[model samples]
Target: MPDGCCSHCSDFGLVCTYVQPQRKRGPKNITIEELSKENASLKAENTSLKVKLLSLSLCSLCSRPLQSLSAQANSSSVFHRSTPESATTPPSPESPEEPPDEQDFTGDDLAERFGSFSIDSLKTKHFGSASTFALANNTLAMKENFLGRPLLIQSRRPLYWDVLPWEKEASNQGSDHVLKFPATDLIAALLDLYFTNVHPTIPILHRPSFERSVAEDLHWRDVEFGALVLSVLAIASRYSHDPRVFLDGEGSLSAGWKFAKQVLTIRQLSEPTIHKVQMYLLLTLYALGTSVPQLSWLFLGVGIRCLQQHGEFRRKPGAHKPAPEEEVWKRAFWSYVVLDRTNCVFLGRPMGLQVEDYDVDFPLEVDDEYWDWGFTQPLGKPSHMSYLVLHVRLCEILGGAMRRLYSSKKAKILMGWDGPEWEQHAVAELDSAMNDYVDSIPPHLRWDPQNLPQGTFFDQSAILHITYNHILIVIHRPYIQKNERPKGPVAFHLCTGGTRHHSHREYVVL
Candidate 1:
């Protein structure tokens, strides 16, 4: 046994074994050399591990405070992500000096830099120093004077259908003519899509009347109804996700041939009718769904004008009892009401048609087939009409919130000290109203995991729940922005529940 072998083995508690002796070297020397090599490798590994630990410990400023990061990102201002090309380059003289530590950059610094600029200017003017803080690499790069607000990268929209080469190419020799009108099969598919998917939720048109128009080929016979039919197809196109028919869901104006025709016709409509009103409503919904809220708001105004022209707001003078046509008009009027109030809440505008000015009761909860005649009784519990009634009730709640929280005058009033109290009370009332609305829903309409029904009927219940959650988020979002409503799960629940479970089902049947 070697003298130092025991020392090495005793320290590490590793047993030293016998080895073949070299010419002049014994087990002691061999063991010492082996121990030295093992110690060197271990030391290198420890040093490497320490380097890794240090690198892992370092986090970017933007990565830690996600709530604050999201708040800053969601602003309508522009933010710049540092490309790999930009990151490796030497700092330019134009770039502002970055703070040594994340702590050195205070919220006050953000305010001082941004406080003077108007939102319009902020949105329009390109800020030089809007370098994006990326969480992926935990990297920070300073830009010029302004700190960049985080923003989603927007995709380029397609060119308008008029500008596309479809017409020009068709005009050239040896090319097939671009479609001037929708094909029979395409129209059939679109109409089927609308009736099966879109109509169940909204149910604005009388199905019997619409089918009669379809049977007569009213789309070609009546220009106005033709325009309205095109709008219905446009809205239905959104649900199709069919590449040939709907080229882009985001830019509907530039996508489908039928949608473009609808827009052109609506723009040139010299005389407006109830059909025109219906067309505008469907167009507004398509616009809103396709990320063109301003256009939706504009269409809302046009639809309201047509409705008012037809005396949709007041009951007819000679009729003691409601006629079938009268009932359709009432349903149409309330559809406008639902849309206008919801749009106003989103756009921060005053309600165009106040509830106080109207006196029509909700349309009877019967299927559209019964609108003109036959079977006044509902067929099933979760029928289309039940969804309509629930939607109307939701609209009523939405209108109340709009009047209290989102009206331009109300918004102005909310900027004062009394705003907090008003906000709290209003939010509470809305929350209470939403709960009651959900409670008021028939047991069949309420969602149940154990008793999930098959088909689009499930969609009504899902829509109710999703819309309720969405409304809850909208109502409490201001409070959430103010750091109140910490317990509110509306946003998270919507992302998880609304999108994951129901959003696919909402349009799948259509």
Candidate 2:
């Protein structure tokens, strides 16, 4: 009945039609009512997602007080959830809320409770957008520049002794006290001490000129006051075993204290003076050796600075001199050589003797004969005899002091030898040479100690003799057996002469 024609009707050759009732027409487009329902459902889902994100952002320990947004905000929660429309939108005043208490979380309280909010974190939070973080850090660093200030501040305790009272007083006192003394007078005094006390054996041709200048300058001081000041400061800062004395205490201004202070004050007067002051300070530090332990670092710093500055100065165009200034340069040249040699021995460096390092150069034509032989002569030479006697006495004193201060083995090693046996042999050789030289010298010349020639010729000749003796001994060292033939020709020659003098008598053993 529902089809267009039934099979029975088609067999009877009659057409039949059947039509089903037409279905009601569906809506052509989505209805506003249905869309409104869908939109409400979507809003509910979005709200649920936003609430989940807010909960995660509040942090796992949200029940506890929060210190930072970054520490709590979960990145995954934030990225997945759509931001609430009202999230970035400012709150209206109509929506009332309790005002946050300013004193609720002090820095200490936050640090104690949160434990993660460091000064750096707080700084980042406060200065997050600022580009001057580096400048601020540098300023903070400067405030902590004192030796142990940072450690003291961090630990909340005194790390070292307080500044001495006398030092504080000295600091307060104006340079007026120092300015009272003429700079020229101070310079003269230093020069006088240097000439009289140090390397006196070395001739100073400029002495007369220096003396005349000092006399003429009545107001002009001889020493570089600035240099003297620097020297004193360097010594006090580093070399004094008891710096508290000079620092601000009762021990201040003791003889040694005054001398050190005076020297330093004079040294600080100018840049040119600094070099001299530094040089002297370094020398004194080396001379003092480990006697002043605190000064070791100071000495190292000064020594390095001096070397660097001097090297740079030498590189300057006109710092180097020609043969014309030989006589004038000789004093400085020899002093530099002595200083370099002494430095090598004291500092255990491989530095050698040279004039260029001292900012001077000797003429090539000046015969080595004119150089002081006091440090170079062998004991048997007349020129070496007096010098050797002085050296032996000094060595004896040094040896005794060393033995008292160090282990016997250490003392021997320090004196440039491996063991006591070597030291003994060296001492004996020096003694024998001196004795031979003294004996060989006519009794009249040997007897007169006060009127000994103070000339450069004698000094230079003595140095040559010793240098030659040293060279010979070094060259023959491997070949010569202990107590066999002395390594040097000077000793052999002297012994041969002694044998000739007493042909019948057997040569006396040392």
Candidate 3:
């Protein structure tokens, strides 16, 4: 029996038998050679068990069952397990190696690559919402703080000198005719000069005398001058660090606004001519509204009065041939509408007009001969002046509605407005208007060089005839707000030269 037990113990090994004592125990003292042999055999058995457990652990499909094996191996003193499957899997293949030499990631590359990255990836990882991403990344990068500013949908053709009728003449005349005291340049120069002389931070352009000369004699009737003023005001409002330039206290802007009001009051402006002036006035008021709310209110009041007075005049008996005063008043009314509409919606105020009330009568009729000029021909004798006024008023109302929707108390404090909803609504309305305007202007009108004026409009009738179509285009384009993004050199040219010029005059806000 002892001989049989001793043989069984030898086969099983002393360590295994010691753990299960009823099976049998090994010899208490043994030769060193025998002990070393036993240790070697135990180590070899432990290593084999460890390898099997590791293989099971690495197989995700079998990992849960492998836990039991791991416990068994641990009991047998085998803890070192191999993860050969995981190690050999090779990091999920490393995204299929990009071409080593390809580098330039242009917009097209970003569109293609990021476009495929999955919106879920963007929302969960990169950007939050589409609107938030667009606002922070694209709009902020373009330096547009105004929420109402339009985004360029696609790359556009550059504004070239050849696009304008006067470009050839201006180029041939060199700097003398092109740059010399043109009414538009003059007003821009004056504003630059005024800002430079008064404000320490603002830089003065090189030709101070030339600029002053242009401003002093600037033709208020010139449509290009109007465009120039709008552009300058838009930029100045956006970039100017000094709020005092436009604010009431001691700045030249207050005086400038007063002066503009005087000019409008003194001059008996024709309809077409006043359209240009009104456009500038509206844009200037918008810029001023950013810094001075009260001043803007004052301007708003003036605009309302102008509209009311004009409405009364139109109602007066037998005013058949639209008097020049009537035209000026009509222009002022529309100017007010545009300015108020923009401010009311953007600044979170109640809308002042209704959509139904937009229809009003005008003395002038649409010339079917100029239908090719790119403006929407009214179905009837649709009052061009009245249409503009009503359009602006409706925009204001929509802006107010939007402001009510997204507005919060915290946002109001930050923006110095009643709510943010109005701004959002206004932005949507403006964007819509821009689209409508772009659509309204026919493709043929864009290429019509003869449609532009020769010089200044000395005769009111000629000016009215020449500018009637273009005024509609200007109102629709709102170029300053529309073409704002810097899209290379070409965008710069269109942005600077796209609109007709107007005289430097104070715009009354009411």
Candidate 4:
């Protein structure tokens, strides 16, 4: 502290009084009002002496000790010093050359600053939060600032383990790929690649809704929204041109593992919503890319159950038109079904969601922009979402084939059938259904490999052919091997056309 600066002033900036008051008792016969006037005059006279405190600014005192400030200003003009010499006395400690905001301070002035700005709030919890991840990292889950205010923590965002390019050089090696443990700013690159490459295939997230949430900056406070954002970034990283994506050991497959792991770290119990379902599906896609189909299956199963719990699966009878928010859920539910049947056929596992259990309608053919409550015949006019609506319808046929050809013991008992005869009968029925579906596909999106679509409809056309062929292979899969057959010749004729394509190689590898 300065030699005579007020020791009681706060540690930052505060004006300290150096004036010593000189007062004496009044004589008898002096009225009480006259004594008050003389005392007030003396107080103003003492304030006339000019004094300046070193490095003191007015801004810090603006809010605190407001009484001292107002008193000096109000009394200065009305009550003046009695002597003529006091007229030339410049100013007191309360006044400075510049206001607090206008004054500028340098490093030298900051070196000896002091004030008390303690915030021992009655509401805040003093104890630290329990966190296994933070404990492992040797850090507090709830950190405090220099002022002793605890940071607000809302979500369990996964620690980032990605290192920057320059950072890798300083470390001399990135052999372990754990040079850093926090996320960097790669959101723009990842989002661009994801929406272009990944979203067209999955089409689970509604673009308009996602964009609006991002614009409103809701992800920082909303747990489910933040989780979905992380999941998307992870999926998009697989297609990013940025070299950092390839730092993980698994090549392009594990490129987004850091973000995927972050999503995994988050744990909270809340009502099921469309955002949670979309996040799960995105995580499932990332897991599938990273050669962890078991993790993919886990995420996929949870997503389907969440969709069911959200009540989008059961259609309301004579229902009123849905709000835009509600329409997104309706669309997300169909997306879950498509993914559900896809995993069911590829993994050769029974379905987690059943067909007959729910009677939900397919999503509109209208794009997200035009999809609104009370909109007329949503599926009547075709738009950007036409591809997804068609994909959902195609997956329904695939789900039916799973139930019929690949029957369960309970199903077999209920619909009694023998070996070869049942196989032949099932193939004929499914073949007819598939043929009808194939004929129903829009002419522009028809699955003809030789006459491929060129521009906007190109991806849509390409995926339909791949899905159609894959489902055909699954329909005749059981009868392909003669060894598995009991006694008779199996159906080799049905497999002739579907397995001839080269595009479905990706699906088979997956």
Candidate 5:
């Protein structure tokens, strides 16, 4: 219409012929250019989607699957970006170590799987069972996640001093129904038994000072310290054969429970002290001895946190200069560690404390008398003190194994291992460590039925032997599922050896 293109053709009047010219096409390059623009847009959109997914994965609270995918994608990108020579070459053995990392808590793997944030996963995955999250946070908190991870028990807006129902039985000090104290004679007997039996194994308290406090009723003045005194009496009563040792028509079990309730009344006191720590430990021990392991394990966590608050693990160097208080605290901390590991093993739970977190020294192997005199006596290789030291060392190893092999994070990682060979290797290493621990025991402490020592020394020997076997069983238990161990050989050697070293009568007595 405008220039060369024909709109219409007409010949003059009649009999005119018309013809259409061949059409000319535009360049094909324009079409290809349009297609290229669309392709670039699509690639950009796909890349944005992938980036979004990776970001979401990074910020996710507990999306394990997404995190794994993101990690794989990232590692792949890193691998592809490497130079051809580096990609083809194997890692050199002489490459510098990465400054000896304390632990590997990479983004993909978090070590604290049972901290405050894990309550939901715990309830969902574990069902009705008590998970480590539940134990660390209160079991009540697990049920009601909104309650949050509070250390003390709560009743409405403020935490109540007395959390347990039984604690209400205690009356105001000046009230008509004031709580009564145990008789002096009963107190004397219980203290005697405690010093004679329990103190040898766990010498956290100084005997003379404790006795003075008890004689003067000094501890009874403060509610928290009073609870500690009551707990000690209650624990000591367990070793007593006489019913009269338990005051107010209470049995040994009831005595402990009554004191436990009193302790609960002061459980949430704003300040934590050494006496309070001791009270919690005694309560845990009492619970364990009575076969209430759940309660024991729970209280063990409480004690551990309390100890941490007191900075027992973070001792001030030279602050308590020349005083044996430092030594006492060290022993107390290790005592808690041993009890913590023991309870965890019994309950099949992860440990609340880790050895790497502690920076305290082990108590010196010396007589308790020397501690009272602010000096340490030279120790023989195979003395009672040596046995105590050896027990702590072995307990540390047991705790390490529990952490390495039984932790939630570690278990999750190992479940993805290529084969069962890794598990076998881990179990074998633990087995060797345990054997070495036993072999390190001095000759005199080692059990001998034929030439057994007199009194409690012989009893300690038998207990040690039984304890060693118990730990062995604990370490090797997972292997039972796959029939990786010959239970008969292990059982036969330990059981028969222990029996030969300590009579069947002794086993019954225990």
Candidate 6:
């Protein structure tokens, strides 16, 4: 801008031909040189502002929505430091070097902070939450909302909360009285279908324990556990070729809606237990499998909320179990987490639950049958739960990929990542982590296109490989140009993985 090309363009190797026009061409005390110097100064200021705007638009893909309300609350200091004179200075890398902590939402009370906004506040924080219909209708609004992602449970309209179908079904005696476990003859077939086709992939429920409970007919005596059984029946019904699965007047893919609906009707979330969590999680799977995906979110949301209540917030895993059902809850909770995160990425929705909110460790890798007994990790055989453990760990990485590649720009900026190079580093770190995870998988559960594992291992292998490829596809999805075909094998592997999901001839490819 020194009476010629501007400095802003020089950094980008471009020459700006912008020149300040003479105002009125009137002679004054200010010399022509002074006027030229002032115009050049203004040009430099504009360029600095443009660079900052460009970074905000391109560098931060998901940065806007998840921005910290607390940061906006404190941005007055940032804005105040920028005097009109500083506009002529070049943009500094240090400005975003030390951003406020995102989790600092816990400390700010909107009511107390009213003083700041009314006094020295620059009005930056007035409307992040409010703009998105996230008004603080309750006393715990600060704790209730994080950045802009909210807890799904709080999103329900409070006025109609009590009238939700689940609420009314609480007193309904429909499924509680009518639906008994299928006559003794049908139970075997449904349970077989569930363990054979479904349980391998989920592996959240303890098959031996569940079978023992059924043998004793104990599930029928307890309403909550009975709901759990019904959920299992609903999920397994999808895999059943038996006519009994549809004796209730529903057809294929909907063979067990009654049982699913019954579980929803009877299992009030008022008392959160491991059985309740498992019930909701299975219901979520059932909803998806039955092609009623609209219901999956509700089921998943309830399941996660219930899992949070079991004190997972404060526990850690050791060599052994915590209490009677502690290990069960832990396994089921992770399954719920995987489901929640998978849904977020697959559907492009925000995460329902962040990993930071809980502290429970992954379930021990021992087979569920031996989980009760000590270190009896099946000798010379594949542990039934090992595949599931690997899958959960893989999803943890997927969650990280989402945060790293797809989370708000504000998050990356706060963390001091300022350019596309940060993304490359993140991708490399994630790719390395993925490689280690694949390597760490036990031999039986590893992906083998030639000799896919059999029986229990089959479904687990299919899901693990499918999810592995799915994560690869997700991580590199941005690099795929708009409306263009992928130029690599990620898509091919995903296609093959889909074919491997089921061992049926149709799902098998030669």
For each candidate in turn, the TM-score is 0.56, 0.30, 0.26, 0.59, 0.59, 0.60
Query: By TM-score, is 2 or 3 better?
Result: 2
Model 4 earns a TM-score of 0.59
**Alpha-carbon runs more than 4 Å astray in model 6:** 1-178, 247-250, 267-269, 317-324, 415-418, 482-510
lDDT of 1: 0.59
Q: How many clashes (backbone N, Cα, C below 3 Å) per candidate?
A: 2, 39, 21, 7, 0, 6
For candidate 6, the per-residue lDDT at 240 reads: 77
Candidate 5 lDDT over 179-285, as tens digits, reads 34577897788889888888777666767667776777755565555677888877887788766655477655555455455555553433345666777888888
Off by over 4 Å in 5: 1-179, 245-255, 315-322, 378-383, 409-419, 481-509
Query: Model 3 segments beyond 4 Å from truth?
Result: 1-290, 309-319, 355-359, 362-439, 444-510
Ranking by lDDT: 6, 4, 1, 5, 2, 3
Output the number of the lDDT-best candidate.
6
Per-model lDDT: 0.59, 0.37, 0.36, 0.59, 0.58, 0.62
Could you tell me how far off, in angstroms, the CA of residue 139 lies in candidate 4 after the best superposition?
A: 55
The ten-residue window of minimal lDDT in model 4 covers 66-75
Candidate 6, residues 411-442, lDDT tens digits: the string is: 88997765866866887898899889888988
Q: Which stretches of candidate 1 lie over 4 Å from their true place?
A: 1-180, 241-255, 265-271, 317-321, 372-375, 378-382, 408-419, 481-510
lDDT of 2 by residue, 402-486 (tens): 2322335564467556654564465466546545544554432332335534443344334433432332233233333445444
Per-residue lDDT for 93 in model 1? 41
What does each candidate score in C-alpha RMSD? 24.7, 30.9, 33.3, 30.2, 18.4, 17.6
Q: Which portions of model 4 show Cα errors greater than 4 Å? A: 1-185, 246-250, 372-381, 417-419, 449-451, 483-490, 502-510
Model 2 segments more than 4 A misplaced: 1-205, 216-223, 226-258, 264-270, 273-334, 352-360, 363-456, 463-510
